[model samples]
Target: MLETLVKNSRTSVDAGVYEIRGAARGGRSIKWKEGRAALITEVKLASPSAGWIREGADPEEIAASMVRGGADALSVLTQPLLFHGSPEYFARVRRSVDVPMIMKDIIVDEAQVAAAEALGADYMLLIQSVFDGGYAHNMDEFIEMGHNRGVRTLLEVHTAAEFERAQNTEADLIGINNRNLDTLEIDLGTTEEILAGRNTRSRVISESGIKSAADIARLKKAGAAGFLVGSGIMGGRDIEGTVREMISAC
Candidate 1:
């Protein structure tokens, strides 16, 4: 995946187009509102399976719209291959918006974390499936490396076992990714399953498979601190208005 991402990124750059990697730096602090689920809107251009979302969609315009629509933070898809996004887009969006920006990429190395921090990212997403131990670090040395650099980590988990491992890590936020990376199949019940029998103190963020405001409400009732919405907003014709409705529903 990393190799494919680099190749695609180079190609896009060669074509004089920027990607959305490391795009969340230099934004306001991430706030996990008490008793309310915040909306983390995504600024996406295209996807491997879904193709282009609003062809020629301007990153700055989308960011501004999300903020105006009441998004608490902005998550820009930074993966170049699968998502057709770039690090440059992330930087531009961060500069254009006041909301906290999260670098949404398939982070596999510490260098990527450093790059995100250098780019002014407020948060870094670490998918459990990609991590060796399904956390930022090994259980014995569970340190929040990214957090120390002023970048919070959102540990993505899909199963109960992964959720258990997340509990051991010192992640500030826990993201329940509804879509299985291996199959790309979405299961809305994943959030409920993960939060079922856990004593997690970390803030919860429901990710993927969120198609409506009712879904947000359901997750909020399940104790999710935020909603990581990507496709729903990106796939919509009116991205800004859709985000606003989702926030109002929450």
Candidate 2:
């Protein structure tokens, strides 16, 4: 499934034209709120690990609930096969939410950056592991493409070594995904383990396995400027309350 997504993304559109078409006008900048850890609540339908997160859930409604709960930013999963996400869902969330949004997907090509911008996303995710595994795409190129199209970039890294690689890029925002792609397992320690004693100007975001206020505090102490939490809120019965509690925890 991963290979197929990468293959299709590589040839899905003409990069040059898509870059031009991706140009857009406005989006809210991600500024961490005072006295609270920046919260980037996500609109995810499913995942390869959890599966069927919230079947038939409405992305726009979820986004609105998140905003009401004081989310600083939003992330919309755009991967279709494994995550059951779509660009249309992203567009809806963008229209409904008045916050910075990151188009979270397995971005393997520059065209995906174009797609994110065309859909009005404020930022696009770039996974270093994808390129490290010998993919033909370049992260720097995609970063430049997003900047040209009026979008920012969030480079994701899962390991300390990957964090080192991320430092090589000009990406200003960095995310540490606690969920391991290979094992599909999550450990809160992953974020701290990767960021321990590290100093950099980039904003560090901890993703996944954020269940309670304590968890948020732990990550904050570990040096995360913000968090990208999804399933905890999306899979819960009370999304608004969950978002509020998570924000308060931060």
The clash count of every prediction, one per candidate, is 10, 0
For each candidate in turn, the TM-score is 0.85, 0.91
* Candidate 1 residue lDDT tens string, 1-250: 3344445544554553432243333535677665567889888788665788767788888888889888999998776766877777888887787778888876655556666776788888876655554433442222255766778778888988888888777887889989876677888899998887667778888998898999998888876878999889888878779998998866
Pick out the ten consecutive residues of candidate 2 with the lowest summed lDDT: 14-23
| Candidate 1 local lDDT, residue 51 | 83
Clashing pairs in 2: none
Candidate 2, residue 188: Cα displacement in angstroms equals: 1.1
Residue-level lDDT tens digits of model 2 in 147-167:
887888899889999999898
What is the C-alpha local distance difference test score of each model? 0.75, 0.82
Best by TM-score: 2
